[model samples]
Target: MQSLSGKTAVISGGAEGIGLALAKGLGALGMNIVLGDIEAKALARAQEIMTDLNIPHLAVEMDVSIRDDWQHTARAAQERFGDIHMLVNNAGVGGGMGALGNLDESGWRWAIDVNLMGVVYGADTFVPLMKGHGEDAWLINVASMAGMAGVPLAGSYTATKAAVVALTEAWSTELADSAIHVSVLAPAFVKTRIHQSHRNRQARYAPTTAPGPEVMKMAKGSAQAVENGIDPELLAKRVLEALDAKETYIFTHPKYRFVTDERSANIAKAFDSAAESPLVADVAEAPMALGFVDS
Candidate 1:
């Protein structure tokens, strides 16, 4: 995983934002690139950028939520650039922005389908192709800091992202013996179109309920925060560094470490409280069963 020269990478959502930045960074390192996105114009612009850089690349119109789209994208990547060494599940949507009961069903579906299920589809479609390639391989799933810490008015987005983080951890263990390494990128905030993700929302998944005033205010504040956040290019560089190091969890902003620490501390305190219960010793001595792992 140290060297990326001459490798091939497939990036979903590669037309813009963090995806495009990663494409640029990886292409600069001599990796053949396959950029996939739902936006045709943006894909064209991405291709033009790669062409200007003289980087060998391909741009494909793809909707990561659709399994058929993923299948087609996989076929295209393999046909254009032999075996795929890296798969970046970067396509995501920011939807379901409201309180639990106030959120729209469509928004929940959109977020879960794109952010969580999309990664699942990508891994299922691409991992087999990457195995035994006689070269280093990796899987990078773009999650968020919201996955680690709860953020108001972004419940569905946080839920899906947290699921992605969990999936990445599980995949890392499952693929531990294989050449394909797995990592989850949990960036706090970046100057990306994710704040305005609704601009690209599909017609069928449009929200049925309008956001409340408080929810609208929170969304605006989030967009402003993202507007003043870290540059995508810098985040891209850091991602490549993490890939080279084979780090499982990649965090972009150090300032958010305190938030994660606090979350972890709260969970530990809950465990401590549980241990103090009268039933603690009996529960501790009982055999624990993990569905995915055998003792």
Candidate 2:
């Protein structure tokens, strides 16, 4: 929709970080909010913040990875808000730090479950309601900058993001004729607790040992990069703008375009010369572990 005023929104992982930021932003725009998170304390804290802001909101303890959980969350949002206009599939976890080979099956699965499957569940659960309403609606899936490019270390994360991008593209095309609009947010970094998410991860996946020294060093750099990354409020604004524009691909920062542009140029040149880049092999070979498979 063009305006968020009086609209209803459900935000997965709304307890903290960018999720909470988007909730507050949408609330300030006069939207009714339903915030979901697995962490009770964080949910409570986020609710308190909403309360102080005089925003009408409800916090639900939810595990976005489960289909039943998403069903329940969708029902709860409709019950509380009367109608749902937006769904932000923002819940995600950093699986672990390592090369593709170093990432174990469990680690890979955990990342895919939360990062990829969570968004899938949210979209599959909410899109029907949005479509049924026959009103303007939006589905915003939070992918990552890594989703756009194959970074060296975060293999599992990149793979899941690629899935998200593909999903968003497919859904956007599929729903183009409908009132529901789909968009994917591929941000490089933002000041958030994603780095520490490894500590609070659920039982589905836990590395036996802490990230190795090399991994730790890379993670440190990544965290620092995020801390200096985009402002969450600004990102929130971009999200709303993307919804209004009906833009399928929502990118937060302009600086990140270099790699994407370089890759695109290479692809175009290869198309002209009948030669292709080897990046396809890396993408196809990246490990995909759904940590909750046995659960």
Candidate 3:
């Protein structure tokens, strides 16, 4: 986990942005790379980038949301490289931006499937393989700044990432005694073509001709944020540093620490004041809107 040298790592969504940046960093550390992406053209570009670096790699087309796709990707990685020492569940999307109440059922399902269940599928498919590889094997899941903090507009995306963060935490706790390490990357805004790419990818995978009217509006808002975010390379470096530290939560922005601290303090105060709390009996559960349901 300290260094990626000689390790065979499978990176989902490795075609561009943070995913490609992480692949390049790992490759520079002398790790063999297996890059998965649904976009053939972008995957080709990614392969070229790795080739320019003279790194050993294989770019495989994969849909992380699909169980069969994940299985095939794992098989392809094993066929090309040996046992995968690390699995990076980095493939994700930025769906149309909208309030939780406005999100459609399809958008909700898409967000949950791609952002949450995709990580689940990746873990189910690759963890067993990683587990057999002895200690030091790692699983890295990319969440977002919204994962820990609730953003008013991006309800679905925030929800999915929160799930990812929570799942990674539980998995880490469960596997603490094992050599396999589970970490989640919770980044703030990062410069990547994720929004456009997600929209484009969705178009390719969609069973319909085009998205609905409301969905298009959401997608546009998301694209704006993606085009104006921070650098992916910096996030990539942070990811490597976190891996070196064997840390569980890899936070991108230092400012986020304040938010986390405030949340923790509020929780502690609430616990201490539970007896005097006024609305404790009204708590109710409902299905959460998550992921990139915005687009």
Candidate 4:
């Protein structure tokens, strides 16, 4: 994982924003790039950028939510570059804004499918291939700081990202003995098009109800925050540094460190309270509930 030169990296959502920045940074390091994106126009633009840089690359129009799309992307990468050394699960969407109960089921499904399941599909499809190479590799799953500390009016998006964080932690443990290194990138707002992610919403997952007043207010504020957020290229540089350092958790925007610390401190306080409460003793003495065992 220390050396990136001559490595091959397959990055989903690589047409624009942070993904495109990552492609540029990694390509500059002499790594072969394979860009996958749902938008054909953006993919074309990304291809042009890569071409201009004289970086060997392949652009594949791919919907990360679709398993077949991932399979095709993997095959294309293998065919173009012998062994995959990096897999960047960067595709994600900003789900509908509303209270948890007020949000449409479609919104939840769309967020989970694209943000969480997309990473799962990428890892499942690529990990075996990477393992076969028997060489050092890296897997970067892009989550968000909102996942670390839940944000109001963005429950679905936060939930999906938090799940990604947990999954990456588990994968890090499971793949500890292997050459594939797993890391989750938890970044704060960046100057990306995620605020306009609704433009790419699938028809089936379209929001059924208009956002409430609070949701709309939050959306406007979030959009403003993103407009003034950190640059994507800066994030890409940090990601490359993390890879070289083999860091498990890659965070951008250190200003948000207080928020993460507050969340952790609150959880720790709750744990302390539970440890001192009589309820803990009662729960420990309670009989375990039995469940059906699959045979």
Q: Which ten residues in a row have the lowest lDDT in candidate 2?
A: 285-294
Clashes per candidate (backbone, < 3 Å): 0, 5, 10, 0
The most accurate candidate by lDDT is 4
lDDT of 1 by residue, 1-295 (tens): 4668888999999999999999999999999999999999999999999999999998899889899999999899889988899999999989779876786889999998889888999999999889857567889999999898878778899999999999998899888878888999999989999998998788989888999998989999999999998999999999988877778999999889998899999999998988888877347543545425554
Clashes by residue pair, model 2: 108-289, 109-289, 109-290, 109-291, 110-291
Per-model CA lDDT versus the true structure:
0.90, 0.85, 0.81, 0.91
| lDDT score of residue 251 within candidate 2 | 85
Instruction: State each model's C-alpha RMSD to the native.
Output: 1.5, 6.9, 6.7, 3.6
Candidate 4 C-alpha lDDT tens digits along 1-295: 4668888999999999999999999999999999999999999999999999999999999898999999999999999998999999999999867886686778889999999999999999999999998899989999999889888888899999999999999899789889999999999989999999988898889788788888888999999999998999999999988887889999988888998899989999998898888868345533543332234
Whose TM-score is higher: candidate 1's or candidate 3's?
Answer: 1
Per-candidate TM-scores read 0.96, 0.89, 0.85, 0.94
Query: Which has the higher TM-score value, candidate number 1 or candidate number 4?
Result: 1
Per-residue alpha-carbon lDDT of candidate 2 for residues 180-285, written as tens digits (9 for 90 to 100): 8788999888988888887657886767545567787898898898889878988998887876777789988878899689889988887765435564533452
Per-residue error for 94 in candidate 2, Å, reads 1.0
Which prediction has more favorable TM-score, 2 or 3? 2
**Ranking of all predicted structures according to TM-score, beginning with the best and ending with the worst:** 1, 4, 2, 3
Residue 98, candidate 1: alpha-carbon lDDT: 86
- Model 1 lDDT, residue 173, Cα: 81
Model 4's lDDT to the true fold?
0.91
Residue 269 of model 2, lDDT score: 85
Provide the lowest-lDDT 10-residue window in model 3: 286-295
